[model samples]
Target: MGIVIKQSIKNTIITFIGFGIGAVNTLFMYPYFLGEDYFGLSGYVLSAANILYPIMSFGIQNTLIKFFNENNKTEHELNSYITYMLLIPLVFIIPLTGLFYFNYDTIAAYESQKNPIIYSFVWVIPLIAIFMGYFEIFYAWLRAHMQSVFGSFVKEVFVRLLISVLLFGVYFKYITPLEFIYSLVFVYGMSLLLIVFYANKIKRIVLRFKVPKQSKAIWTYTIFIILSASIANMLLDIDKYMIKHYMDIDNIAFYSVAIFIAMVISVPSRAMHQITYPITAKLMSEQKWEELNELYKKTSITLQVIGGLILVGILVNINQLYLLLPKEYSQGLFVVFTIGLSKYFDLILGNNNAIIFNSKYYKAVLSLGIVLVLLIVLLNMYFIPHFGLNGAAFATLIAITLYSLAKLLFVVLRMKLFPFTYKTIVALGVVLISFFAFYYWDFSFHPMLNIICKSILVSIFYLGLCHVLKISSDINFVMRSIFNKVFKKQ
Candidate 1:
């Protein structure tokens, strides 16, 4: 536990650094410098890349994890499988690139505020997708082998920092916004090379260039996993694409802004999930069902506590948040709750999807993922027409909660495991108390200053409340052990 905390502290610091740059880029500079419409365009371009992501890669990312860890697949066999998997994108990439080259003008013919540079980069999407897929799989390989911090830092921290530099060039007029945005796709390609380098530095990921023998059963599983992953990604990202057709770019910008902030609610859980994955895999390898169950409950509560604080902090002071943004972004306030709730539900279901994916019941995961995607689309269709962005928000909230609850229900019934307990409610109380305390107090300062001050006040109140509630006892036990080691060294 002490070791986990030491490592988690480092990961958390780096993750927050990434989040800081991302928050500034997405929320402030993108909105302030690029303007709402172009910001929306930027959002759309990234969304389109993500939407194409799972398709171009052909589930190679997931296939790598499943294959690499299986002893039956020799190191050479694993490399061959991965090599074939990476090449799988060529099948779609050739056609997609040709399509873009021939019909780009026709494809870019939307009501979008036109930029020829953007269309030029449309070809980069499939190319970038090919490498991004390989990059993610390579990162996952590092993860499976219990080297999560570097992978997480590379992913959550470094990539976004590089993006901030690119955007800074645009803001300073050193590069045209078009060039800056166009370079965005290339950043992904660059990231792939970095990941490959890091993975090799840690332990050689054999890169044999030949296909391996796999039975008919393996192909069936591979196909199912790819289709399942593709469908699931569509559910997450299709909203951004659909908004372009039904609404204006400014509205899309606002919705994207709101979702971006709301996603901050889920970052801690996401970072923690990376570290938890290989540990979960280790348990699965050993057939430690009871330990796995205990870990699940602990992991869920830890995420819920952290996630609950974030959601509470955001909602309680969202008015002040909008005060910092431009007037057009004020409309996003109502949607923040919906988006925040969606991420909250996802956080509470910590590692559930990974658990299912690692288990023999993975087919159920694919089937359920498809069903959830359909539900989200149907809900978005119904809501986007009537409520506009707010409607989209409600639809997202409903879809995410429903999707998460379904996974939780599956885990409970099939595996006889549930992650709720009295400790969970206590943690919720701690966050809620801090939320109201910081929210209601008047801080005589600038909006940015108020933001910083309010955040500090919240932290102090929350930590103080933890002490009063005896949560400090459990935490101190961990801290004391950490310091004991330091003292002995001294």
Candidate 2:
């Protein structure tokens, strides 16, 4: 766990810094600088592209991690394997490119029925999708080599920083709204290039046409994962995409702000998963069930503790935080609460995704993901027309809850492993207690001050309780280490 902790802390810091910049962009710059309509348009374009990139990449990103292991493969075999990873995506990318080129008018018309402004940006979707697809493939390549920090920085910090600069460009009238939208293609393209350069520096990618022995299994997993990845991405971005059908494009911007607030709860999980994912894959590959289960439990509680603090902090300070946003944007309060809760549920699952994806029963889980995507789409279809933005949040919460439970049950039943323990219950107790304790009481200070004060109170109360109850020894150790260092310096 030494390397895990060391890297996770670094990744956590990096992710938070990224989210900090992202918070500014999502919360302030996009709203104020670009105005709501273009902000929503930008959000819509990116969401659409996110939904498409998995199919374009053909799941090579995840496949790389699941398969790459130095213990089992020679350098030649590894090169052949990576060569296959590179080529498989072209099989999808080329056909999709041709389809988009020929049928773009039809595609654009269908998507932009409610918002004609979206039609012009439709071509950019596949272009950015191509960039995003390759970026993840290369990022996965780095993670396979257990070198994720630089890639994490590139993904989390670098991309958001570029968005900030671009948003400022829009602010100063240096870039037209359309130019700003088009610049996204260049931003993601440059991002992919940076990751590719770093990946090459780690190990020069060599092309070898020799087919790996596990070609059969590899293709099978890739096919299922492509569908699975597509479904997963759809589940995330479909609400934003579908919103255009039921609501104004500006509503997407409102919904995105709330979603971004909720998404901060996921940063710790994202940071930890970068390191833990490949580790989980290796553990499962080695058939080290004991260590695997132990890791499962530790990661669950640790993330629960960290994610819980963020969730509690957000929920308790939500009202004051919303006060800081434009009055129109505050309509997403329920969206924040609902999606924040769902994200917290997801965080507590620890490396559940990594475990399941690396397991043999992945095909079954993929089926569940398909059902979830359909369910979410149907729910959004029915709910959005009636309840508007909150309805989308409701649909996501329900779909995520049901899907998370199903995955948990499948893992327990199939593998006889569980992520919960007595500590989990204690951690939940701490979270609930902290929320109830601080939520009803707020300083009569400025909204920002109220949020800062309330957040500090919530953090102290929540983390202090965790320390007392010992919800996660890993967290407690870090807390103690910080305290010891502070006192020593004094």
Candidate No. with top TM-score: 2
What 10-residue stretch in candidate 2 is worst by lDDT? Answer: 69-78
TM-score for each of the candidates: 0.89, 0.98
Give the alpha carbon lDDT tens digit for every residue of 332-447 in model 1: 88888888877887888767876776677778777777777888788888888888989888877777777788878988899887887777778777877777666676577787
lDDT, candidate 2, 1-490, per-residue tens: 8778989999999999999999999999998999999999999999999999999899999998998873236888888888889999999899879988999899999989998999899999999999999999998998888888998899899999999999999889899888999999999999999999999999888888988878888899999989988987887789999999989899999999999999999999999999999999999999999999999999999999999999999999999988888899999999999999999999999999999989999999987898889999999999999999999999999998998899999999999999999988888888898889888988999999998888877778788888988889899999999999999999
Off by over 4 Å in 1: 1-7, 72-78, 81-85, 88-106, 110-121, 209-218, 467-490
Candidate 2, residue 413: CA error in Å?
0.5
After aligning candidate 2 to the native by TM-score, how far in Å is the CA of 156 from where it should be? 0.7
TM-score of 1: 0.89
